[model samples]
Target: MRGMTDLGPLSLSPVMKPADPPGEPLPGIIKTKVFKEEDYINMPWKNGLGGTKQIAIHPHTADFETEEFIWRLALSEVRDSCSFSVFPGYDIALLLLPEDERDGSASVKNTVHLRRGSLTSPVALHHNDQATAVPLRPLTPYTYSGEWPTSCKIRTGPMRHLTFIANRELTRVTATLETICLHGLHDDGECSDSDEAVHKAPGEVNGTKKDATGNGNGTALPLGDECKNPMNGNVNKLLIGNYSIVYVVSGAVRVTIEGTLEPHTVLAGQTLVCERDDDSSPTDLAMTPLRKDGRAFEKESEHQDATVLIIQVNILRPERRRHSSLSDVSSFSQARPRGRSGSIIVYDDQPLPPLAGIDGDTAASSAARAVAGPSSPTSTIPMRSWDSARHYKPPVFSSRFKNESEVPPAVVRDQLIIDEFPVGAISTVWINMVKQGLSEWLRIPVIVARGKEEGPVVGITAVVHGNELNGVPCIHRVISDIDVSTLKGTVVAVPCINVPGYLRYTREFSDGKDLNRMFPGSPTGTASQIYAYNIMEKVVGHFNYLIDLHTASFGRVNSYYVRSDMNDAASAAMAKLQQPQVILHNSGQDGALRSAAMTRNIKAITVEIGNPQQLQNQYVQWSYQGVMRILSWLNMFQLDPADLAPAAGPPSSTILCSKGYWIYTKTGGVLEVYPSVNTVVRKGDLIARIKNIFGNIVDEVYAPGSGVTIGRSSNPVAMAGDRVLHMGVIKREGEVLAREAKENY
Candidate 1:
């Protein structure tokens, strides 16, 4: 035991342990040493390809600071640049790494940022081919590269980086390997280029881009000799043919075959390759680097860009290689005539490795068909292909409202209980409440307002359509101004109807069903229908008089009017409450709550005010003024109606028609209406014309009989048989004519 020092107190010096061991370095070589700002050569390579700078590093150079190659331009700001290697006798693996974090290797046709240390497979190619090293932004769009094939038969897309194997000794270059650290939950495990990458070609134009100038054919070249140069006893042996395999590597990649390179996504640690050989079945091979490159590379760039490593390996028979070099093996080459169609087969000369079968190495070659899925015969069946589909579960609907008391009451004069309907009636009633960031568990307050004193129940509703928000605030203003303290009756103000649609700020509900048309709906119907039913049976049923509020749909403007069933006592009573510019005495069709209310001897009138999708001060004011007038009439509020006539609502001509004739267009086209609503037309009158976009007449819509035009199409566009106009015949006109003839007698 150590003894303590003398003095009041003594502190021990803290001993430091060595920093946690540096992360285990990745498994492969970093060919291009993590570049320095000085490593980028300012000198340009001027060829027929134009002036381009280059940075060439010999194989197996060991000076690496990071796994990623970081190069910066000397310009004021960095411009996007591409790096490539011209391997005359062998294929080199190259990845397009962008410093921009927004770039993604997975994205098609757009720049996509990727996580650090992501990599793609080795891109293979023929000898002496100048392939693209990378892609850039607005300046060097993927489309600007002349190497990218353009097809009128297909939609154009961005060009991608190319990795190719040269024509010589079938060199096998694993992608510039990178190690990715797993974070969050996106842990699929580390991946690297599989043997499949070397044999696969890029994607074909998606039928949208057809190469009329390029030859669509396949040719087979024989390997008379094999390259004996070996870094290790284990060397990649690729059979001659069009092979489909996922190049397990990083970043973006492309495979060019028969002159067209198809784009593919190469993810880090995982293989992404396709094997579809023009000859025989696609072959899958393992990508193993027998040679050691001492250069140290960053797993990711300092800027956090991704990297990719690719390999192309060719195998030759032992007998063929004895007489000549690997390039001289032309005896096995066979050139098919021009326009050769379909696939060709190249037999494998060597035995498969024992581990290859179990490791699913052959699966990569089979995976080629997986790209097109079951539709392509070349695809191998996926492991899950035979599995049964899991059962689907319906969405569970929960109610936000707990109970009756939790229901909020939009109280008016602090007494009348204007209750909204059940919460389950609308699927999205709580959507607006959610956007307001209200608790899903908390019930919303009912919009109805009431008077302090009890009397005849009078319900005022506005904005049956959600887009008509103007009516809601207008009714709110009207209810607030009412002095219900002196009221002789109960005034229930429902400031909003079609609440779901209102939340969406649209005229139609979430189901695209109009809440207005779904009157007296079934209890088991959809949300919109259920809402209508609940309001009619629960809310409307409580009142002796009902005023349904509404507004024109978007793109429509109309004069203020009141719709009431003629010859009905309640309808007549309610019609007197609206001081509208036009009081239309109309009969209700089936499913209308007003008609149902008429059956119950309850007064109900639907008031149309303002336009859809927008609110107007004048309309709101008019609505407020009209509501106040009605309140005054009922003695709920005391107010002097000077400008507004105190006498009933108004004296207006009653237009009657047993049947309304609807004029429909015979063909689909644009409709041009000459007469507006309220225009009197005779039978066979040209009410409208339909013409195609080219201005050629398609059809003419004519009036069926003498009548007044009451409605016309609001939308200029129309389909065949679409109703263009409606004509209301005046039976009274016939009566007047007959009466004048009788007076002559």
Candidate 2:
């Protein structure tokens, strides 16, 4: 009964007391209340599968038995395979909480299965089913309709999750769950007076300054001069919807709403609820640390780094009732089958319904469409069984080609195909290139591999610069070794996108243009432009995710690293999963393939392997392992024991640099690089020294800033203003780096 006090029904008195009219200086004040961990209400699930710790419910005093509440927020734990309680008229959003282990080594095996209509039916045939055989990392939230009798199976042990449920007809809910690490906090019991002084006022320490809009970088800060008072701490503005809730997973803090001067101290594992004011204005609130004898505890030891989960529930217009005929019900029932083993099964003879339109589009043209949109497409494609190694036949093409119209059609099977390749098979296609004369023609080699099951379409292109040969064999091995029967998606690989450059052992195409710089190319442009246009339209545009592999150009060597825009959550997540030795947080330059793909909303990343022109076996292996990790992370394929690299320790520590630069030589000479790739260097550290033909030292290059070497020029010869070393400046501290680096390929 400690935290279980009944606050009675929410009051509208505060908003009704306001005098401000529309467009006035001030709107109505919001009513906010704090609910501590001790006050949480424990309730049994209606289905008896598990129990939930109720944080707050609408109508204020509504209990679990109260059937008319508009929205509800709670935390639940699943220990075994149990059916979820069915709420026929509600929609639910669930987010899996990260485990306590910081190294991400904890074992977590949880599987979610969903079925529509009845609880008596098996839990198979759910489109959104996901199994986490490996540890479950914090991912984007998963949402489903409450009409479905969803269930969870704990393959290894128990799992905890935060959930938001709302009435589908009367309310709409949007939830985003992210984990932010607060650095510079000490874990020890010692605290300094200076730390407490810094916490007395908001935006006073550790780059916490707020802009004119009351926003501090990505952190939301309190608005106006109201935050200047030490007693008030810092105030933050909240535009409350029908209801708003903020829950603390770790650490402690204080909160105060506009109507009251007294602040409420909310510790870790506590929840705060803010009810919408009667008037239609945003809310004002302030937050600070729990104070003891008028002094704030600022040390991280007193308040560990916190991860807060924010949820918003809004009231929307009621959904129109749909009248379904008996035939409609029967057709849907055919797709849902009840099995004796409590596993849902789909019949082979049942015809699949068309994919529901995403964003109101009636139909999707390709597999990529299913992933980019909100809905999954219905596929009639049956799973095929085939021997990938023995039966695979690389497609052959005739050299004599008249025009683009003469290109052959892709081989299709099981509703899945990639340009001349059938499902569960690997084949090659000869993409027509420019001709030297009327009789002689040129073509680029394209490898296409289609998986047996229906999933997203992923495009992988390597050797775009022609001279980058490390990726060519890596692509071949990936395509040849995949067990098509287990794959859930399609794989399209282009071993050599620039055939002319590869044949000529150069980085640019025959027209002396960088192929990578000409993306979504214009059809009426130059030859390279036309080629780029064809690939973007016929290939890259249809991909949900793209991985463009490359190596350091001719004279340079690079550490096994990833170049990605860290600002993007999705791209950053994918890059972290690869566990590379290093990562460059770069917003790609203009016209780059990665940049072009992003404009079209396709998630893409560029991977830098070893040196160019030669296929280093070690780098090839590393590249292969990295790609497998990506595929596994996406749930496109299961990780095979043979394909698994040696048991990895904690991921290699990652250093994120917002800005990076290349050190250029001031005088022409023969260059000698002193440090290897991935070596950390400080300003004035010896990086390289240039010598003239007579063996006399010409100039010595020193590190310009404290950073790690990502790439360096390998060729001995150098010219004035020529880049010799590329370094990334380290600015953030306490950021987790992978503990150990993976073996270099």
Candidate 3:
């Protein structure tokens, strides 16, 4: 039997290791090697329609024609319709290269017909019966399985494409290709032949002349005074897993590695390959544009920039183990030989009770059960303690509270007894769950601050939608400012509720479930549900009041506002305490934390800060102040009257609306918003305009009712039905009618 090594945790596997020392490979590491363009093997395709340039192959010894390779990358040109090679167990990905510049929009009428089982079979992949064209865009890749006798026919003239193939049973491979045109680098606005234009010396356009000082034609601007490649300052380190290849598409670049003395010049149509031990430190490489003649320059020079396509490959193995600090244990069955008597047992070299019939099962069956348990050869098993039960210490309250004997006891006195926290102290607790494979634990941090005096327990949760990061700092500030000993009651803060999404920099769980929608979650449900259940049961149910912090979704900006069920006096009062510029009378959405708390008779409101993903300091500070104000209003904390700033006159009466709608664009184009968030508008007011690529206005979006803009799209590109603005119609004070009558056309 083959013994497998276990990698401790999945959370740490994706992190790149630090750079290794020069010239030494780490132990147990798989080595990587780079393959250059000139080194690629030139051979005829299996179908012989055109030749193929084999980029790299796994197991180095595998030949394209004779031996079975685990994976391969290659390029081929198609001049005529042709059959493709059949690989019984391989998955294939194909990318169409840019159309030949010489072709230049002559209505080439290109179509690629694909058949799965045989060349004579009907099309297996097509848009419709009338359209057989494979939408092959430049640098855009299409992936398909090559397990059967698959082939494709190209109707247009000669076209070149790239292909990637990997054995479905052995390895997984992914490829991405993008081309960045450097036409903007030429200030003279002159075009040249494809190859010559790409290789032109920096600072010198084809039709332009240069003087002794190395400046281009007087009319053309010098390529920035220093001539430095903008990419030189970037960190371009690559971790060599198994094998990796970088191909220059249409530009020249200088490559510098740690151990190399001088940077190597790589030109268009060339490749720079590097092979290193997988477990070794990362290989840091700096790439910049190469000067003419590949000469080294101390200062910036006139050099054209190039676009490069990088492809990374990793060889998969069954017993792969990652470095970790956790301890690994061996189960009893794994330690004993096959057919061993189950009646015999040992613990720390001491004999224990026999395994024969403790549970009324036969010894042979018991042995089989042990082998079928949750333990695997490649799993990191945890060792059990000699003592079967755990002992927990009791928490002691602050001595200062002993003198106040007249004070009434808390309604939930036993709550603190089970909790591992001392009264009048701030501490953190981890809510842990067994991961799916029982290979690791998923831990969520919960910060708790208990007060010596009894008052209302408040809960603050942020990052419910992981990308809404602005509220994270607000919670941090609230926690830091509240002195546990002086605070009344208690404050619980969960700075990042969606741990998985926060780690991945996304807005949802790994399973694609929205965490916010899994409130009052079920224990037997999905991952998000389990997490939500634990939080609501352990933290939310104990709160007397709750503030759920959030921000706009990605690519959108929002003004500071509060959303609460204004019909409920308690919820309405909590919303008003935030002192936001806009207060929306919204009944929290079902499954939302705020809604769940409201049902529990807890006053709750959601604070909508600025943008998502990024922490805007101004908005963060604003949210922090808002939270502090709420605390002061509840009498949970006190501040000197003299220190309070003067209130900004009478607040614009809170905008009351039954609901709001996000206005979407009817057409797709480059959108230009005419108003910012919080701007008031009348019916028919122009809110945005869409322009075609040619700078012609295509359409204009106007407000359908008198309302205030609470949110608007920040991304310039828009597709049909993409939300462009979020408007809240004013329903109180007759403001809508007055504005409409005043702005009558």
Candidate 4:
């Protein structure tokens, strides 16, 4: 009843609004069209397990993959039990239309997101709880996350149902059903096709309906045959909006746009669409049944008999959702739909921007965008649609792990190619990279400093995350200081692992993937996965030890630290030699290079430098000496005790933490975190405060336990679940815990 119709409950948690919308609507724009049943195109489902009748889909060229289509309406056929194809970032609605069978029904078995393709802890939506699931009842609409891996099981034989898919990031979607009564309409059954009119009358629309008297001989048919079903006497107006879909299940409907005298008649089995400019506010719609030229029929006066489905979709603008209200959402780990593997925890990476193209603003990125493969900004949509063939093509990505045949013929190590560098000399080895889906190779330069005497091969990797550039300079200094003649084993350094991301100034791979999280990737995987696989197989597999260097990404800062599996003797020793500000004793099994190298029996430790995208000379020099210490400890090189001193802020007695977790904001506001990078807090100390723009404090965060601040959000703007601080629960805050770091549990 409002400007835009109020919809029923939404399926997913609400997201923060953007500071501004893309643009306003074109002036005075409104378009209307009607499509008959014959217009629907039948297509096979994404899984190829079944088929569907696509009644309507925005951007018709959109394929099964990606979130290119804003909304889609389809009638799906479920013959055998099968899973629903994953559509990771879209809102989905479904309704089971009546089908023939005794005690007949179909139920969707599960809904859960992709957990590395392992299905666990399924939420059965057939009879799901009201809060989490849309109750499955005939003709009753229910909604769920399309990202979840869903499947259907039929109670009877083959089943048919309706599905509505919409990207809430692009537009808001809602549906309602109402009956159209036939009891009070003209008995003549006269519908104006303009051609069907027997007599030409005044006030007749060029292509609209309604104009005759009752033919007493005609029988009033309600819902086709009333004897086979039920009866009612209530008529409802169409719930059309800025973007609306009017699907009449029975009887003819007359659509009359305001300020227009002409009325168009849409017969049964027809869909009428009302569309307005994306930035324009919705207007009220006028609708009635098709009858002889007569007075408009009011909904309250007629008996409901036939049904019409109305779907109202409104593009969300910043003006609609911008507010200072706090949201209830769990931290990233808990927000995931299912359990993460026992050892793999992916909480180390930074949060994505609120929207792809935006700088910090009204919203912090939600867990969804943090996990989406790649997408358009949540606040903007494509200006063009599939009205014709000349529109933007949806993004596509594919790649495979490099095979031996893909490697370069020469200049190599481990027979993954040619002549290897001689011992006792520093050389640059160009590792061939397989271009995604192409035969050409992209060479990745690896610095290999082979020692005169063979010992353990230590691999140092930096810039796996494109923007974490502190590691780049840190690696350069470490390498330049070492002379191959005195060094023992071979030391290899990959200074810019994600070249594409580095070139693009992003934190991920060219395809918007985290190379650090791909691990020893698969032969059949995404672009990032393939590259990661090559790094592990052709390059890292030769190392006896691995050191992955990193730094904090945009909008955040970190203390110089070492992340290692302290339980492992070799890993612990490597971490200790760094003399960092903090040492995190984590399992390190999250798809990270540390854990990936561990799988191949390579002792690995991740040294996180401070800041990103630029070299911090002090930290670089400090960490470079740390690398010399590690080489000295490994008997690969000798180091002078004089070089043990750091060039940075603190003297090197490291704080050891058993584990770390982010203290998140429960509300979004202008935030101020109180601690410096390595500051230690007593339990219950004030850590961060969130204030509204008006300068009044709205929320305060306190340390739940004694811990060292490893990293904290630097941006003043914060959203619910945004990081306040990465608190490392200390085993010892000021001490390096010499005995414990050596061997004790």
- Select the stronger candidate by TM-score from 3 and 4: 4
Give per-residue CA lDDT, model 3, range 48-152, as digits (tens): 234567665543433344444556667776544444554555666665654433234543235232211223322123322223545444444566555343334
Evaluated at residue 295, the lDDT of candidate 1 is 16
Using TM-score as the yardstick, the better of models 2 and 3 is 2
Ten-residue stretch with the least lDDT total in model 2? 398-407
Q: What is the lDDT of residue 445 in candidate 4?
A: 69
User: Which ten residues in a row are the worst by lDDT in model 3?
Assistant: 6-15
- Candidates in order have lDDT scores of 0.39, 0.57, 0.57, 0.60
State the displacement of the C-alpha of residue 62, model 1, in Å, after optimal TM-score superposition: 88
Question: What stretches of model 3 exceed 4 Å from their correct place?
Answer: 1-419, 433-438, 640-658, 734-745
Report the lDDT of model 4 for residue 584: 89
Error of 2 at 707 (Å): 0.5
List model 1 lDDT by residue over 339-374, tens digit each. 112112211211332322212335554564354344
RMSD of each: 30.6, 30.3, 33.2, 24.9
lDDT of 4: 0.60
Better of 2 and 4 by lDDT: 4
What's the best-to-worst order under lDDT? 4, 2, 3, 1
